[model samples]
Target: MIETIYFAGGCFWGVEGYFQRIPGVVKTEVGYANGETENPTYEEVCYRNTGHSEAVKVDYDEDKILLIELLNKYYQIIDPYSLNKQGNDIGTQYRTGIYTSNDTQMKIAKNFLNKKQQKTDRKIQIEVKPIKNFCRAEEYHQNYLEKNPNGYCHINLNEANQYSKSHLTPIQYEVTQNNGTELPNTGKYNDFDNPGLYVDIVSGEPLFLSTDKFQSNCGWPAFSKPVEKLNEKIDTSAGMIRTEVRSRKADSHLGHVFNDGPGGSTRYCINSAALKFIPYDQLEKEGYGKYKKILASNF
Candidate 1:
């Protein structure tokens, strides 16, 4: 199911870019929300007393992401204590807010605020109001970051990518974030041989292929190679100068690479909690059709 929410955090350019990186997020549109005037233009909202705040409407799939998780994600980038401004932008238009169209969203926003209040003594300055009025911003403001990669963004895109994958199962979290290794022969993918893709559990970044998977009796899912190089990194953090692998977008902790496999190929002994398998039949619908051919020939 698809759901919509609007977030007024600093500039819509950066806010929209941050949410769009999330896997379940379908699309984002920059706009002016909860304004006083009828369909105020960008300049009017900025210069004139239109009482409008720059915001972005996000559309996402509920099955892939939760509203509560999205709310927490929203809080990570903005300063809740700041008033009528965010980042370097100083104006009423840049004020932080959560304008919801429904009562359920209203409740979510309030609950989020209340929990945050319990943690800190400072009062949250964010506005939580029903959607009074909204107008889509100029075409130039929509998807601004995608058009200009080097554009100014208050939230770091690299860190935002990791935060985008915050909705994690407990085991997934322990294994991916804490460097806790799953016991040998206890993982789900250890002996499973099927045509599909293994993706990072946290960030959904594609990592390895079933075709390259080989049983080395290592008691873990062993792959001779990675499907793509961008999904990993080399690390030497743990005493042994081992080639540590990480998800490129999220920089998530995946398994390591070793050279003790057949054909001089490397072995990637990954933990089951660190991955989510996408079977061949569901690849295309899941936006991984480009790799369907990888499962064409039976091994």
Candidate 2:
């Protein structure tokens, strides 16, 4: 299913460019929103004292990306604490906001804001309200960054391509999406030992630690325990009872678990395609920096 959210983070040029690179984002259009006037133009909204903020209307597939995840990514670029500005662009038109059409999205948007408040000492100045009025920006403004490569953009586009960097192969998508199993002993981390963290392929949620990995000789990565328990349920299908592992955030189908493991451990035999490894050195860049100290202590 597809859902739409309007994000106003300073200039829509950079905001639209950022989300357009995301995998699940279906479409993006620059526009003016929550203004008093109807059919507000770029000139009127920017200089004529219109209340509209430069915004980007983002449409995305919910199956591929969660609203919470997208909201988190959006916050990475903007100075939510700053009022009526982002970088050198100082004006009310560049104010940050999250405009939604319905009550459900409004709740999620506010919840995201509340969590963000706990992280910083500075007050969040971004607005969260129901969109009262909206109109598309001019044709040239729709994809300003794409058309003019050297456009004025405050945010780095790399922030939005983190998930794209872990691009999946055909087989990986088949296993994670279709719930298929990889052939035994052929997995990448089956016998490999490295001090790092493993994350979900789709949502990038941390799943396992190298410290918990044990040599069960099971042909796949054998984990004595996950970093934390995954949101999975027991599977009793095809007349076979097994504890199936699944990514709760991304809803991707991982592998199953078994009791026959080393050290009297409950083995979690997971598929390589369902996971992406973040090396100890790159953990900080991958947003799992907290685990670096954990790996160091274990080492």
Error of 1 at 262 (Å): 3.6
TM-score of each predicted structure versus truth:
0.62, 0.57
Weakest ten-residue segment in model 1 by summed lDDT: 157-166
Error of 2 at 219 (Å): 30
- What is candidate 1's lDDT per residue for 1-299, written digit by digit as tens? 67888999999988987877676776689999998887889889988989999999988778888899888888988999999889999988999999887899999899999999999999899999998788999999987876676799887665564663366766677777777678889898988988899987765668888888889998888888777774445566766677777665345677888888897767887888888899999988776777787677644
Ten-residue segment with the worst summed lDDT in candidate 2? 158-167
Assess candidate 1 and give its TM-score to the true structure.
0.62
lDDT score for candidate 1 against the true structure: 0.81
Off by over 4 Å in 2: 166-299
List runs of model 1 lying over 4 Å from the truth: 2-6, 11-59, 75-77, 87-93, 97-170, 231-234, 259-261, 284-290, 293-299
Clash pairs of candidate 1? 235-244
lDDT of 1 at 24: 74
